[model samples]
Target: MNKQDALSIVETHLTKKRFEHTVRVAETAVTLANLYQVSAKKAEIAAIFHDYCKYRSLEEMMRIIETSYLPKDLLLYHHELWHGPVASIKVEEEYGITDEEIKSAIYCHTTGKAHMGKLDLIIFVADYIEPGRSFPGLEEVREMATTDLLKTAWMISRNTINFLMEKKNRIYPDTFHAYNDLTRLLDGGNHFEQNAIGNIETSSGSM
Candidate 1:
């Protein structure tokens, strides 16, 4: 589907807030796509559909997963990660969205995969830094997306893994894979050491 067609479908399917987020991510994806020399149209379409299934009830998502061919390990330990791929299937089955780049971007936007392409990176980072997600270090990530997309993805992936650990949640293996893949890109550091230290210092100063 083209940009406007995709936007309309997303608008009709998503709630008002989600629709807004989709638009924001679309814009952000377009910006990153231009910077990275990827297709702006494909980036926007992927961003628009990336969260199409995000607000579906857990039961609904589970039902979709149950019917799909996603592996048992993914259904068990990485179900959170499966939703994106499941949603990609639904997008195609429901809307005839056969564009490979858009479908692949939606499929991996949640936990990421090994060897992501430029459009994948754009959609991933756009979803992360969309305006409403006002998490700490987002500004740094946003800046890094322009200058260093892979490094920014690495930082975000590490922070996501740590957050899940603190909550005693089941971490998706794909997330770990994504982190390790980016760590190799980091050219070697103590993973999150310096960032954690800087965050602690900043928190103490703020207090």
Candidate 2:
């Protein structure tokens, strides 16, 4: 689908504020996709639809989760986690969007999983670092995004984990898995030192 068509369809499902956020995310995702050598069209489409199911009733989301191919364990966690997986299926059934790469990016955009593909990383980081969001350590991640996609994703995953930890929330296991996967790729299992990112704080926004 073209960008205008995609955005129009997505706008109906989101609040006005959320639609604006989606537009910003699509722009950011396109930039990241170009910088990181991913498909920009896919990035834009995935970002536009990333929050498609965000405002769905909990009962409807739960029904989709229980009936669809998504993991049922997600029901035990916060309902916020349910939207991504449900949207993954909805995009296919509603829009005839059968692209696995786009579906995977949409499914895992909220809480990234291990071994993410380039397009997945693009949507994940774009959603976090978009201009509409403001959180700790975001500047550092944005700086790194221009040079290194893996490190940027790692920073986001780390900040998100720390934020959830500070709130004493039960984190989804896939989130930690994303951090581990990116850490391994960032510096071969070594930690990012001050010389790299320079005392970046944790993020608590737009996860």
Candidate 3:
């Protein structure tokens, strides 16, 4: 579906605050898409659908996980993280989202992935640093998005991992893989030395 169409579909079910966040994510995703030379339309689609299942009950999330064809690795993760991927499947079947690019963007938006596409990176980072997000260091990432999308994503991934680790939460394996994946990309390049190192200082004193 097109951008407006996708937004309308999501707006119908999401709460007002959630819809606003989705819109902000769409706007931010488009900004990142332009900088990264990705398709803005794809970024918009991904952003709009990124939280399509956020309001679903935990029981419903589990039911989808059980039958949504999620990978064995993804199943090992909790329902919260698994919800995004499973939601992608439900959105596809229920909302007529047939494009694999958009589907993959939605699927990987939560716990990024190895060698992500430009649109996927945009959706992931946009969701993290959208205008309404006031988490510590969000402004840093908001600034990084303009000149260094991949590095920004890497840092965000690191922060996310650290936050979960501090809460003693179940760290999704995809998150660790995503951090290493982006680090690999940076190591393969030469522009961002600081970010390439992946030094995220956590409350636990690990860097």
Go through the candidates in order and give the clash count of each. Answer: 0, 0, 0
Residue 193's C-alpha lDDT in candidate 2?
51
RMSD over all Cα atoms, model 3: 8.8
Evaluated with TM-score, which candidate comes out highest? 2
The regions of model 2 sitting more than 4 angstroms off are: 189-207
* Model 3 poorest 10 in a row by lDDT: 198-207
Question: Any runs in candidate 3 off by more than 4 Å, and if so which?
Answer: 72-76, 189-207
Note the residue pairs that clash in candidate 1: none
Per-residue alpha-carbon lDDT of model 3 for 82-173, expressed as tens digits?
Answer: 65887788777897776666777889888898767666677889999989889778888888888988889899999999999999988877
After superposition of all CA atoms, the RMSD between model 2 and the true structure is 7.9
List the candidate 1 regions with Cα displacement exceeding 4 Å: 77-80, 188-207
The local distance difference test score of each candidate is 0.75, 0.85, 0.78
List of clashing residue pairs for candidate 3: none
Prediction 2 TM-score vs. true: 0.89
Best by lDDT: 2
Q: Model 1, range 1-207, lDDT digits (tens) per residue?
A: 677887887787788998898899999998887777676777777898898887677777777777777645666764457668877888888887776667778988888766666666678888998877897778988888889877878878888888899999998777888888778757765434533311212111100
| lDDT accuracy of residue 191 in candidate 2 | 34
